[model samples]
Target: MSDAVAAPVLTIDGPSGSGKGTISRAVAAHLGWHYLDSGALYRAVGVAAGWNDIDLADPAALVRCTFDTRVGFRDAPGGEPRVLINDVDATDELRTETAGAAASAIAAIPEVRAALKERQRAFRQAPGLVADGRDMGTVIFPDARWKVFLTASAEERAERRYKQLMDKGVSVTLAGLLREILARDARDANRPVAPLRPAEDAVRIDTTGMGIDDVVARVLALIDG
Candidate 1:
């Protein structure tokens, strides 16, 4: 492989609403590197499966959908990246709680992870890659030069998510979001395959009260040091 193909990666792993997505994108843009939102990939797969009526309970069907799914991403500066599923813009749908639940369910299947592993790695190229997801540092890019794990209180994360949804005009209660965040945290941390956890060498950032720019600066500092 050429040097560009083997470009360094900065993996930012964290639970939902901990700001990894925002931070990673900022850092990547600052460094002029590519960005990978692995969670979006899973969401895309889940969304596609639903469209095809493939039962999430059926590991076989989910794996097939993963293989057949043609996921795409479009950069939308200053906003969330647009996600396309099989040539259709499913960006809005992919961000819904329903899609998140489905993604979580299918992500636990070893077969689904295996199928998406290479697809995730393919984003590494050119200047570098900044990957954001639960296992970006642990499973997908263990050799990443810069690995950071972000975290926040479950309640805080839920509140952040609640406000985001409300801003988007989605009707949701903070209590329900809190419950879902807690449940997903437990499920992700306990899943049998590639469970969610920080790599031993990863720098842990408690972003409970930190601003997005501050967090991005801290991540960039890692490269400077």
Candidate 2:
């Protein structure tokens, strides 16, 4: 059989509310590449676990949930992609602080991360892929042709998340969101498996005051450069 070159991958990794999702989606659309929201997978698993009343502390149950959860995404041309869990539209729930917390909890479990690793890698397909998550560069796609780690100060990220939730009419306190983001950051950074960090050679962007279009252009410039 003739050898075929593998499709390229661009990874955008960062802590919660770091603009990874926004920038990754924009870049992917510009390049006409497939997109993978790895965080959504974990959130789906967490949501699935809760539906089955499976305890997050139970690693075994979480693994089963990972395998059993059927996660699908439907493109929403001008808005956030719809996340379906078990074919049910759970996009709203998935965007909740509760779901984010659940995802972080399950993500810290080594078993769950291991279970989801292959699933994340499989998103890399023909044309290319823009994979976004906490460990997209470090663990899921270490050899990705382009890798970017976007970060903003804790306060800034919290502010961004607050505004996002407010826009959706989800009541939330800025102080509470800040606390949650700090806690999740600690957990993700100290997690045993695939801790969140920039890959050694990955470009780092502190998008503390940058606009979405500016950030998107910078990332695209990398691949085009």
Candidate 3:
């Protein structure tokens, strides 16, 4: 961030099911700052492209999806983030495993990343911004004043995901979730573009057993001090 003009940004980067989304939202709300759910942007692009039957292999098609897609976030204090694509409520669909896989895949394309780079950065407005994603701190907001890398053991993350799905009445096995998570971990960590790793200046928070409030408080302290 350039000292002359850039607004403040607090980046929270992590893998799926790591509570990055939840924690970042809470912190943003608590601070009255705008929040960015960067993963949802990729997922929205993938889903919108799928709706139009755009070939995923064609980088041009994917690039067009980024421009044609309209994503909106409707979030309130003490509420879950709601995602809308093309003026339609896509919050539930965006949370599906299929959408996540698509996001992870399209995220590898250099064109796609280039397209969304400024889109993500535009979230930096007003008082501050709490941006959450796999590469927010490492790539999107490298100069953010506060950076947090939230993570958990694979087993623990899988368990957390299992409960969340079960609560939604979606039947899923724990073993399957764990296997999928590990697979995605390997994929994200080894992806050619923007691999999933913490920025050297980031504070790593292992959230394996800690509650949401505790993690939020820890991150808040980073900027508060």
Candidate 4:
């Protein structure tokens, strides 16, 4: 395989709780393509910085940390994929609300985004790639053959997140989760660097009332067409 050739990519961009992650994984699996969870990269960075007691507000420091960090993703024995930071399994650590908030804060830094750009793009391989992120279609894979923007109402998203957390035995209030979701949405959509907006050529899917299978089927039809 020639290293110079860019692999075709299917970009799935959306905010949190939009089912983009699950849908992207399904699409990648169906097409036998590599998958890139770009948000997990940021979350891993945030987790690593927290482990080292680094301040997120320091853009220069965060950028340096991003380059110095080594993030890996691999399937766990009986669960979802695991995230590794410097060989340490931080899969669970990176999913905390704290880490997510920290990630959002640092992702606003242009330097941090630039540092992770190539790393995220490297997942594209011979077969193809399915990239899921807030800006995958808008920035990371603008030339992607397929671009989708998934979304859901804030209330629905909050309920989904609350249920997810509760299932894992995490103590969190639905109202609080809703507030945080709204706050994160505001920050993500208003950020100056690659704000969370659908690409012009991207298809928008509101997953508020759709099941996973339904969403997947719709996306597959688009790809087939």
Candidate 5:
């Protein structure tokens, strides 16, 4: 097993719609480093179990399914991340509200997190790794060279989510989206395994009013410095 000290990692962690995903991807692209969307891994597990009719509450069953399953990410031309589960293109399937909620639930389980820990860490390679997820900084990549916690107001996040879904042709009301976002945030922050929080040394960026380019530029400066 490789020690955290052996490789450099940049972790960007925060709640949904805080632009962590987009920022992390851009950072990885700018730095020519690898990227890991850790949340997608849990979502893939939830999706696989759902397809097989396995009960998510069953820890033993989830552990078996988590290990037996294989998940991978592929960049699409212009869209959200594509998730491939067990060789099948489940890009669209894994993005639904159901999958996201299921992922949050499963991620709370100790055994499930234990199963995916090494897989997430293995993304650290020669150049570096930019990891994005709720716990990337708090847990998975605690020793990261640079850790950032990107966040925005709940209302702002909901609006962002609403626009994203609408742009993707998914019909969703703003109020409904707001409620869901709040609920998920509460759950994620209260989970026992790796509750969402900024690492002690993490730089917190409130992207509520910042432009993407500005945020990227600021993050780049931090990385360079």
Candidate 6:
């Protein structure tokens, strides 16, 4: 493939609260490249399914949801990612924990994955893309020139999530968050399709107690290498 057509992609895959979202956004902004929050795409899809009263358990419903869904990202270059569904700004609603659970639930549907696969790939256009999600490196952008799998201890991740929600004035328990994180991890790891896993060639980083800049620096160093 020509260099222009073969746009470089940096795939950062990890579970929730692993700092993938923050690090990927920073990297994309630093490089002046396009940013793809693949998780947000699924979250938006889940929100759309809920709005249409579609059953996420129904495989056919999942297929239709993916086909009929319209997700857009505003200010994806260097600002807070805002998601729009069907031309309507659903950013706030899609950021809720409820929406995230729905995303985790629907992401396991094979039909839904197939439907949105090309949509994710389409983001690999001119310039480049920093794609972040559970399976970005393994499934969404297997040919990405740089691949990093970020992770953190479950307890640490839970604490991080708790702090974020508390900062937003959302009442939540760290213990509850920990339980939910473990459950989601099990689900993601055991999902039949596109299960959460680092690609064989991926470099894994444990951000247990590291600050965002430290982790970002490590990833940037990897990119430089």
Each candidate's clash count: 0, 0, 0, 0, 0, 0
**Residues 177-210, candidate 1, lDDT per residue (tens digit)?**
9999999999999999999999999999999988
- Lowest summed-lDDT stretch of 10 residues in model 1? 1-10
The clash tally of candidate 4 reads: 0
How are the candidates ranked when ordered by lDDT, highest leading? 1, 2, 3, 6, 4, 5
Per-residue alpha-carbon lDDT of candidate 3 for residues 26-92, written as tens digits (9 for 90 to 100): 9988898888999999999999988999887889989989998999988654578788999999988
lDDT of each: 0.93, 0.92, 0.90, 0.89, 0.88, 0.90
TM-score of each: 0.98, 0.97, 0.95, 0.96, 0.95, 0.95
lDDT by residue for model 6 (1-225), tens: 864459999999998999999999898877888888999989988999899998879989878888888898777444577788999999888877889899999999888888889999888976888999999999988889999999999999999999988987889999999999999999999999999999999999999989999998998898788
Q: Candidate 3: where are CA atoms >4 Å away?
A: 1-4
Instruction: Count residue pairs with overlapping backbones in model 2.
Output: 0
Q: Which candidate comes out best when scored by TM-score? A: 1
Give the poorly placed runs of model 5, Cα more than 4 Å off: 1-5, 78-81
The candidates, ranked best first by TM-score, are: 1, 2, 4, 6, 3, 5
lDDT at 127 for candidate 5? 76
lDDT of 2 by residue, 55-114 (tens): 889998889889988999998879879999999999999999989999999999888899
Tens-digit lDDT track of model 4 for 143-220: 888899999999999898899889989999999999999999999999999999999999999999899999999898
Better model by lDDT, 1 or 5?
1
**For candidate 4, what is the TM-score?**
0.96
Q: What is the lDDT of residue 114 in candidate 1?
A: 97
